[model samples]
Target chain A: MSSKPESDHDVVVAGGGAGGIGAALGAAKAGARVLLVEKYGFLGGAATSSNVLAYCGFYKQGPEPVKVVGGVADLVLDEIKGLGLGCEPFRSPTTDNWIILLEPETVKLALDRVLDAHGVQVLLHTRVAAVSRTADRLQAVTLAGMEGRWRVAAEAFVDATGDANLALIAGLPCRTGDDAGYLQAATGPIRVGGRDRSVPIDRARIVAAFKEYNWTGAHPTARQDGGIFAEVPVAGDMWWMMYDHELVDLTSKSFTQAEMAARSAAGDYVKVLRERVPGFENAFLLQTGPQIGIRESRHPPARYELTGEDLLSGRRRPDGIARAAWPMEDHSVPGRPVYRSIGGEGFADIPLDCLRALGLENLYYAGRTIGADAAAYASIRVMGTAFATGEAAGTAAAGPDDRIEGTAT
Target chain B: MWRKSGRFQSLAHATAGEMPAKRSCPGISRDIALLLLFATDDLAAESVAGTCNSEAVSHHGLERDFCSSVILSLPIPIMCGAISAIQGHVLGLRR
Candidate 1:
C-alpha cells in the first residue's frame, strides 16, 4: 500500500535471527535492496546469543532423514560445510528427530559470510524501536543504535523479531503465548568441556546424577530423565539441554532471574557430573549462555492463522509458500515436552497468507511472528521452518516484480 | 552500576509460574532496571566496534567504516555509557 514514496531500502527486515537472515537474503537475491537489523553484535540469533547449538526442523522423523527445508537455507548449510563443519543431519537419540549440530563461533562466522555474499546490508547492534504507520500500511521504523536513533522509511517491512516487536510497536493486535496465557518453558542449553570422549554417554548415570542432586545439591534440576545430550560438532564438547525453567512472565526481571538460576544450576550440575559420571570426572561448564533460550513470546495475527488441524492433517495448499516438517513439539509443561508428528507425508504446506499481516498491506510476518494457533506455532516456529517463511515473506514484500512464481491462491 | 529495584524483590528467587501479567512490554523503566543489572557483564559497544573495525573491513566496508567513525570518535568508556543511555532514552527509560 506504499505510494511509491522515496525510501531507504526496498525491504527492511527487523531481527537478525534465522528468520531475519532468510528474509534479508531472500529479498536481496530477488533483486531488491535489503537491510537487516539485529540487536546483538553477531548474526546468529538463538544459536549465538543463547546456547541453542543445534539446527532443528531440517529433517523429518523417520528411519531415514528426509530433507524438508531448502532454498536460501541451503546457502547456510553450504557455507557451514565450506567452513569444514559437518552439515549432515544427525539423528537425535532423545527426540529421534534429525538435526544439524552447531558450534556457535562457526555459525556466527558462516552467517556473516553468507549474508555478505548476498549483498544484504546488515546493521548489527541495532534495534527497531518505534514504527510509523498509516491505517493499513507501514511507512518506516526508527532504528535505535549505539550512536543515536534514526528513522528509515521502507517500502515493505518484515517482522522477524521472534517476539513480534515490530507489530507490537506498530499497534497491531498480537497474542501472547496461548489463548490461556500459558507459555512454553524456556531452556538453557550448556556446553561441558574436559569430558572424556572415550567413554560413551550413559543415560542411566545422568538420571542418577539428577536424582542425587535433587536430594543434596543446592540447585536441583526438574528434569529427572536424561534430557537432550549430544556431542557438539568440531569442538567435541558435550551439548546438554537438561536445564529447563518456566518463564514467570515476559518482563526482563523474570528473564534475568531465569538466566541467573540457569547459570547457577549449570555450575552445580557440572560438579555432580564430575563426581558421579565416569566420563566426566574433569567435566567443567564451558558455556552457560550469553542469554537464555526463549521458546515462545508474541504472535501477531496474519491474514490466515495456520491451524493445528492443518498441521495434524499435513495439508498441502495450492498457495503453499513453505513446507513445515517439524513435529508439534510442545513444551507447555516445564521439563516435559510432547511431540506430535505431522500426518500424511510428514510435512505440511504453510500458505502464503500466513505471512501476510491482516489489515496491513506493506507489513509482513516471518519466523515466530507468523500467524498460527498454539500447536501450529509450535510446529512452524523452528529455525528450519523460519528460513522458509522468511524467504517467502521477503520475496512477497519485494512488490511482485520478482515475486515467487507458480504459488497462486 | 544498576541497583536492584524493589519491583524485583518478589520475583528474585521465584521458580514457579505464578507471574501476574502475561505478555506486555514491561515498559521502559523495568527494561532499564534489567539492563542496568546485567549491563556490566553484557560487555559494552567496544567489542562490537572492534569487530566492525577488523573482521567486517573486508566484507562490509561501508558499515564497518560507519561503525568505526561513529564508535571510535569518542573514547570507549564514554561511548559505552552513552550508547546505553541513548538506548535507554530511545526505549523511553529516560526523558
Candidate 2:
C-alpha cells in the first residue's frame, strides 16, 4: 500500500456511467479492490443523468444484428434481462443501426446490483475535485461528496468521466471538441405523455407542424425536420429528441444557458405538437431532462489517437481491446448531424493504447475520454463502446500484465 | 390490458411490431411479429401506401399487431415512416 495517502484502493474509477461501471466491475473481477465514484446521486451516467436512453455500438449496423461488444458488458445485460425487460437489440428503422433501448430507473437498479455483486465500493453524489500525481504517475484523487471532501490513493486510476475531468485535473494535454474547437450541438430528449395512444403518429403531420412552428413560433427549433422519436420501453411514452442547442463555450454558465434555452424550446414544442399534430393533441411533456445530452466536450490525448481513417477502413490491431461499430455521427452544426458508415468489416478495433493516457503512466481513459480524432470520436463515444473500452482500461489498470478476456469477437 | 413486468417495473407495452402473441388476431404469431419488426424500409413505405384493410393485414402479417387487436399497439408503418422521414432530413442522413 502507498503509505503517503490517506486511503487506498487498487483502482479508482472517476465516473458512474457505463465506462466507470465497466471499469469498477472489470477491476474487481480481476481480483483488485475498486472504488467507483459518481457525480450524480445514482449511476447510469447519461441514461439517468441526461436522459440519453440508448446503448449503441453493442451491435453492428447490418442486415442482421451482430453482437460486437461482450465480456463485462454482458454482466449488465444479464442483470437487465433478469429484471424481465427484453434486452434485445432494437433496430432503428431510419439508420438501420442496432441500439439497446434503456429505461433509466431499471438501468439504475440493475447497475447497482451488478456493481454490488462484483463487490465494488461505490460513492454517489461525488466528484473528482483534484488529482495528485508525480511526473508520470497519478498518486491520488480528492473526492467531494455530501459527507465532505476526502483524499483517496489508488495504485491505478481510470478516467471515465466522459468530459475528461480526471485527465484535465492531472494537467495532461487535452483538446476541446475537434481540432477546430467546434463542439457538436447538445440535444434535449424529452418524454411526451398524455398522448392519444389510440391514434397513430403521422410523420407528415409532424413535419408540416415543424415547418409552421419554425416560421413564427416563439421558440423556433433549428431542427427543420422533426427530430428523432422512439417508444420509451417502460413508460410507453414518446421519446422525442426535438431540440438542439449549440454550445457557445465550455463554461458552466454557457452550459446553463444552453440547458435553459432547450427547456424553453421544449415547452413551445409541446404546445405546437398539441395544436398541430393529431395524436399529440393532448401530448404533455413528461420529462424535459435533468440536463441536456452533451455530444462532445473536453477530450484528453492518449498513447495513440484513433483517426477517422481507421474507422472508415475498419482497421484491426493486435493490441486492440474494443470494437468501434457505431458510425461517425458528427453534429458540429446545431440541428445538423452527419453520419459516415464504417467500411471494410463494418467495425474498427480500438487498440489498448487508445485507452492509455499519453503522458500519465498509470492513468487510463474510457468512454468518451479515450483518445480519438473528431471523426473516430463520433463512432466510439457511445455507451456500448464505452463499456468495452472501460473494461479493457479497468483490466489493464488492475495489473500491468493482465489482458482483457473474451471481449474482441 | 397493460400488465406490469416484475423487477424493472416496466409496463408490458407492445412496440411497433412486437405485440404479444395472445393479443394478436387469429393468424398472427410471435415469429410473424419478429418478421414485421425487421421488415425493410421499402416494405414499410409500401405498407403505408395502402389503407389498414384485411388485404394489407394478411400480406404483411399485420393481422392484429399493426392494425386491430392489442390495446397498446404502435403500428409499424407509423413508426418506420416517422424514422424514414427523419433520415430524409437534409442534415441528418447521407448514404
Candidate 3:
C-alpha cells in the first residue's frame, strides 16, 4: 500500500497489541479522533502476527470462574464466542494452557471493526521512529512508512508499544530488569499443527522426563500440556508455544534486529520441540512470530508500587481498576518457569493510581508497560489484566475531568 | 515496563475516566496507573533519575507543591497523588 502525507489527529497510539488496540478503541469510543501506527500488517501484536496461541490472565479461579478483567476482557471473550472459536480456558496449567483462546484472524477482524466504528485511522506497516515533544509536552510523532516519512500530531498520545518504545524515545522515565540487568526470558512463539486431536498429550511423561533425564535439546523445552505454554486460537490445529531465552533483547528500538533474533530464537526453540514433545511424531511447524513476547519494561510512577503482598492478599484498592489471577510466571533459567501464585488465597485488584504517569497530564498506561517491580510485573503482565488496564486507562485518559488524587505516601 | 506480578488499571486518565476536561482532584482515590506516554515534550519528572529507583519519583522536588495544589484545587482524582502543584516550578520537566 502507498503512504499518505503527514496528518493531524486527536489521539495517536503507537502500539498495536492488546493494549494499543484497547487504547485506540477506548479513546475513539470516547469521541476522540485517533491514529494507530503499527510496524506489522496486522494489529493483534503477539496474538495475531506473532501467533501467540492463548490469551493469558483473564479469569479468577475456583468453581464459579470469577473474573476481574471485565470490560475489554469480556469483549475479547465475547468476540471469540461470536466467531465460534473452539477453545476453552485451561482448567489447569496442562489442559489447554490458555485463559482466552483468541483466533488471530478473528482478532484482526474485531480490531478492524472496532477501529472502523470509531473511525480510528490505522497505519499498518508503519513504525514510530521519533517522538516530537516540546518541554515534556508531546507535539507530534514522526513515522516511517511507504511514503518514507510523515508526522502525526495529537492532543494525547499512548505508548501501547509493548516495549514502551514511545516512552524511551520521548526521554521518559523507564526501567528494564533487576539491578543485575537480569531481564525475563522472551520467547519466539511458534505454531505447529496437524496433530491427532484425539491424542491426549502425555504431559506426565514429558514433564517427568525433563525432570528425570534433564533433556537438553539446544533450546528450552516444555510439554505441550505442561506447566508452561500459552494458547492462541486459529484455523486448522495450531498451538503458540512460549519457551525461554534470556539474552535475546526484544526491547531494542531496532525493528530488524529484534525481529531477526526473535525468529532465530524461535527456530532454535522449535528444533528442541521436535526433539522433546511426545506427540511430534507427525506435528508440522506452521508459523513462528517476529516479535519476542516481552515480559517486563518501563513502569509508571503513580500512587503506589504494587507489591507481592498486595497480589497474594488479593487486595483491592478503593481505586482498584482491575484484578489478576495469573500466577507469577517467569522463564529465565528454563529448568521450570517460575510460577508464584499470588497468595493462593484470592485475586488482587490494581488501583487506578497505578496507571497515572506522575508528571504527564492525561498520559495513561496499560498492559505490560506500566511501572512495576521485577517481582510485581511477573504477576500482572498477563493479557487478561492488560485488557482491563487498557479499558480503564483509555476511559480514564478520556474522563470527563482531569482531577488527580493527592499522594498518600 | 514488564517486571511481572499483578497490574493496576486507569482512573487517573480522568475523573471516572474523564480528562482534557475536568482538572480537579477529589478524594483519596488509590489510583496507581501510569501509561507513560511522553510528548517529544519533557513535561515533568514523573520518575527519579534512572529507572533503578521507582519509589523515588522524578518529581524533581515539586511533588509536594503539586500534591498540595491538587488537594486544594478540584475533585477530579480526589484521594490520589498529583505530580506537581506549581506546574512551571518543575525542574526535569523543563526540556
Candidate 4:
C-alpha cells in the first residue's frame, strides 16, 4: 500500500445537491480546506439537474410567513436575488406556504459563484467509487470521473449524495422508505415556454383532458393530487410543469425508463394543453429535467432518528441545529399527497444527531438522506431544509473533534 | 359534508367532470378531515386579508398578472380544483 496520503483535504463532501453545497460552504467558512465532489458537470444537483426550481421549507407557514433558517441559506437567496435570477418569496396558492422560484440556469451560476468565493474546491462529473475506512473512521474515498480513478483523503466526510451513497459504501446501516421500503414517487419537471401570459389555462380542464386521453402512465388517479400539483410560472410566458414518474427504483435501467416515460408524458401533456386548454394554445415544451428527481431512497442511521410523531408533535431537541417549517408532505401515495401540519409553531427543530451516522465517527450525512422516518423525511427533505441540515453537518465536521456545542444529545 | 365550505362549493362548480362522491372510506375521510382542519384554520385567519388578492411576484422581475388575477377572483375550491390532480400509486411497502 502507498504510504502517502492521497490528495489530502480537511473535508470532503460527496454529492453536489443543496446539502453538498451547504456542507462545502460551511466547512470552508469554518476554516477547513474543503472539496465538493458531484456526479454532474454543474453545481446545483436537484435544483439544476432535476429542474426543481422552487425552494420549499424556507419559511413557517400560517397566517403570516416567517423566515426560520438564515446563515448560508440567506446568502444563497441574496446572491440569487442580486443576480435577478430568482423570485421573491410568494405564497403557494395550493399549500399556502411561501416558496422562492428561481431560474435554473441562473441557480447554477449562483452556486458556482458562492463556492468559488468560499475557496471550496469542486470536482464536477465525479462520483464516489469506493470508500476506505479503518474500523469506525472513514479514511479516504476513491473517486471516478473522466480523469479516471483518484483517491481523496480527508479528516471528515459528509454524505450528501441524497441517497446516502457514501455511508452505504462505507458499510454503515441505512434504511429506505418505511419498514416496507416504499419510497415516495419521483418527478421530472419540464420547462414550457410561449404560454399565453394574458390568459390563465384551466388546470381542472387540463387534468380531465389528460385522463380522457388515457395517458396517466403509472398514476391512474392523476386527478386528486395537491402537492405543488400544477405548472408554476417561472418567468413571463415560461413555466415549469411537474409531472409524476410514480415509484421508481434507484437503478440505471429504472431511471432510463422513467426519463423516456417523462419525456413522452411531457409531449402528451403539452399536446393536451395546446389542444384542450385555452391559454396554452401556443405553449410548447422547452426541456425536461436533466434527470428524474428522486424524492427518497437510502437514509443512513443516525444517533437519533426523527420520526413522523416527532414532526406531528413539534418536537424540539436542545441540540437542534435547524428548523423545518414545511408540513409532512408524503408523496408516497399516488393522486393527492398526505399532508400533516407541523403541530406547534408550524416548525420542527432538526437536531445535530440527524446528520451524524451512528456507527461511524467521522461520517456525516445531510439532504434527503438524513435520519428520518418516511413522513418526517418528507417534511425536511425539501431544498430549503436540506440547506440548513447540510450547513449544520459541514459546521460540525469542521469543528475540533466534532465538538459542536449544543449538538450533544 | 365538506361541500358546506364556500371553497369546496366553488370547486364543485368549476370542474367539468363529476366530482368523486364524498369519499366514504373511514381512513380517507379521517385524513381529509385532518387536512381540512388545518386548511380551515388558516382560511379563517386569512379571511380578513381581503379576497386573496396577493400578486404572484417573481423575484426575477417578471409579472404574472394572469396567474395573480386568477388566484384573486377564484374561490378556494376553484383554486384547489386547479391545483389537484390524480396520479397512480398508494403509500405502501415497496412491492
TM-score of chain A of each: 0.95, 0.95, 0.83, 0.93
lDDT of each structure?
Answer: 0.76, 0.75, 0.57, 0.68
DockQ, structure candidate 4: 0.01
Off by over 4 Å in 4: A1-5, A215-221, A225-234, A240-242, A402-409, B1-95
lDDT of 1 by residue, A137-181 (tens): 999998887877788888899999999999999999888899998
A59-138 in candidate 3: lDDT tens per residue?
66555545545554455556666777754656545532236666678877777766676677999988888877777477
Residue A140, model 2, lDDT: 91
In model 1, the Cα lDDT at residue B55 comes to: 31
For candidate 4, what is the total of clashing residue pairs?
Answer: 16
Ranking by TM-score: 2, 1, 4, 3
Which model scores highest in DockQ?
3
Per-model TM-score versus the true fold: 0.78, 0.78, 0.71, 0.76
TM-score of 2: 0.78
lDDT of model 1, residue B27: 31
Error of 2 at A127 (Å): 0.8
Report the lDDT tens digits of candidate 2 across residue range A1-409. Answer: 2233377998999999989988887777656889999988899888888888889888888889888787688899899889876779999755678999888889999999999999899999888999888999999999888877789999899999999999999998789988889888888988889898888777788888888888887667766557777788877888888788888779999998988988888888888889988988778988977778988899998988999999999986645667888999988888777889988788887877888898888999989999899999999889988888888788668755312111101
Model 3 sits at a Cα RMSD from the real structure of: 12.1
CAPRI-style docking class of model 2 based on DockQ? incorrect
lDDT of 4 by residue, A320-373 (tens): 667777888888764456778887877777777788888888888878878887
